[model samples]
Target: MGVTKPFPASVPLSSRAYIDRMDAGLTSVAGAQEIISMISSRRIVTKLILGHNELSDNGCIVLFKFLGSAIGRKYQITEISLNSNSIGNRGLLAISDYLQGNTVLKELFLQDNNFSEDPEVFITFIRALNASHLEVLSLTTNRNLSDPFAETFLPILETPHLRELHLSAIGLTPQSGSPLVAYISSPRCRLQTLKCNGNSLGFRAVKSIIRAIERHNFSLLTVELHANHLVGPVSSDNTSEEDGDEETGGPASPDAWKASETQIRRVLFRNSHLKRETEKEAIRLFRYARPLLLCSSKHANAPAPSTSTRCTDCSCSEIPSPNAPEPEPDTPASNRPPVEGIFPFHALPTELQLYTLSFLAPSLSPAQRSRIYNFASSPSTLPRLGLCLPSFSSNSRNTCVLDPASMPFGLNANTMSPGGGCAGGKCAGSKNSVLCHKEKQRGEWLAVVGCSAYDPYREGEGEGVGEAGILPETGGAV
Candidate 1:
């Protein structure tokens, strides 16, 4: 049968679509085809939910054919749910083939399905997972998968994009524990959620898992161990360490199990705190960086004056005047090429640039940091207010220029105290002291109130206020 036509225009395009249970007679191959066709037509649909439909292998095969097609490639779907659909290896392999070339899909839910019937199918799926962008996967209650399944799935944990995994009640045994612990302990493991509850894991295996979580798996936030063989009471007569090795389907003692649980929780708490702080820092940095990097729409689209060299609302003037000598034809902002005034530093990924700045800012010297701040700040802030005061020493007549950049607390009346630059009260005692030189000359004040300063020539004192400590060439602007 032919695929169904697209939905009518009367229906608004939505980002998410739900077709649960397939009560609309969409449980067969024709139904799958119709669903795929409808979703493909709506380019805005990013999430597709079709769970509990029992669309077995036949329907799944048909669905995947559309997903792997060129028309499917044009769709923006990033999430797909096929849970409890009675899908088997053939259907899963087909999905795997689609994933090999797909980059948009980040979530796939296939819980309570009939998978692992053929081990090679899972092997191929793992290979496809390595190439895919899928981040969250659910395979819960697929009890057919055994220890070998865990061995084969170890590589999926290494997939950087796969963050959350649900493998609960998959018939895993004690043999699968070593491989899981080893993988979790690896520094490259980035899996954040690992749910393996309802498994047959023993005491030693649980202990190993806890130890690995405590030592290496800081990214993991939720590790469901409920309903697993984890804890059991111990007899007071068996006090030796060997008693813990018996592995009677539970921990050697209830106390030991509680201790392990407590330790894991502490580690997870620390990790959670660190993650929150990191996110807060990232947000703070982005707040500061966004205005400097992004061009406002008003400035981005403003037309340039024919006679003027720049726009008043934009930083286009900051670019070399000669580079844009002629006025170009007007175009939409979206179609325009990148503005020359925008720094290439903004081209880096947002997270990477923010992190780089966070690490780099602390290591920079005060002067270097000031220069960076000036660069990032508005053009009006680039001009520092110069303070010129008459020399207070009896021997000199030149003025002292205080560059706020050199001052520890910045240039202000409070920081211009006698103890700052004047040594031995020479400036306070001299007739030429700021207190006595209250005259104004050519829009310049010879002295500032509430401060007795300006003995910039004292040796071993007022070192930075001397002639040699005047504003550097770069800081001499205004």
Candidate 2:
């Protein structure tokens, strides 16, 4: 027994040497805590890698307490990676407080630490971090969130100079996080990189964010959102009813809202000249003129979806209009998802879509509503946005499938309908007046257009030539 003696590895001299390569295999929060005491004894330890360990808030606190002390001040610890841990809002809250106090520490890696994405945690912590000089914050795999913060971490929005923000796999639906949508539209944010993949930010959010980035002058380059269900995983048979063609690509419903801030950002960014540009600005100004209600809770629960937009088989042949851009291999459809901006469009309740299209009518904002209105209303001056206009499918050139309703501007179905008219203005009388009826009647006019122009998606094929009428509410729930 007297033959051997072991040197304490935690002693500052040896610990400092080992700290440089400190790969402590502390497994759980408990293990991490037990080793904290040993590590705390060292005076010069700077970097710590507790990755692949299950360190929770309690365990991290033990380390944070010491780090927050005079010992922590002595060391210029800059990096911390807490990978593989269930550190939710509570843990993030603790870290946020610690971060506010410790400005020396920069580059915090909270990856795999299940941080609570509640709007409060994000907002409060970010606001509290007014003293934080830290940059490069990563919160991956911490899904559980609601509302605004669920899809996007609002705290990062506050960081004026912070460079990178990674929020991959944060639990959310394509429709979630409108608050952040509003935030991104704000001209104040100064973020460079935003990486959100493996989460459901939806096609609409993706397009909205991208367009906003390009419009707002954010120094951003990378955008990722995959693996999460953007297009509802539906079988050929199990299709959504909203996809039906009843509303002529979903009428512009009352709930439809224009991405006004985004439009304003676009106008501010792009030096517009054409009718489309002026009309776009004018319509956006009209929408923004009316203020929106401030959203409080991040996951403040809202009413569930009353209906969803489903695909309708309208005009399976010929391009709906010449406005849609043809998909090319070299196009952004290359690295970017083809259906990226599509989720919000699909998420558009059938009724909302209709209303959007109606206001999209060839009215005061005809040039602006080109994508939403009757083809005639759209200005010849405004060149088509590649996406808004329909395209012939690659699968079969002769058999063209058009997403004619895929317009950048929103069209609420409620306002666009002509009561019983089809050609952009009010229907004079007989069912012939309604576009729906014309399609059903197989009139020479609709026949001339092949229903592609009137029933772009072919939503009402089965409804049989009924007069233009309000679609009967199909008791569906989201």
Q: What is the lDDT of every predicted structure here? A: 0.57, 0.45
Summing lDDT over every window of 10 consecutive residues in candidate 2, give the lowest-scoring window: 469-478
Off by over 4 Å in 2: 1-30, 33-43, 117-119, 146-148, 227-478
C-alpha lDDT of residue 468 in model 1: 19
In order of appearance, the predictions have TM-scores of 0.55, 0.43
lDDT by residue for model 1 (1-478), tens: 9999987767342323433333354676976877877775553567778887767899999888887788777776788888778888989988999888567998999888888656688788988887776889888899988778887778454455677888899887767877888887774456678898898775567667877776566567778765656333422222122334554543456766576678778877866765554334433433464354333222344453233233232223233324444324364334446668885554555446544665533322233222233333322222232232323432122323333444556456345643333332333324443432212221011011100111112131221111111222122111
What is the clash count for each candidate, in the order shown? 0, 51
Question: Model 2 — TM-score against the truth?
Answer: 0.43
Best by lDDT: 1
The residue-level lDDT of candidate 1 at 270 comes to 69
Candidate 2, residue 124: the lDDT equals: 65
Total backbone collisions, model 2: 51
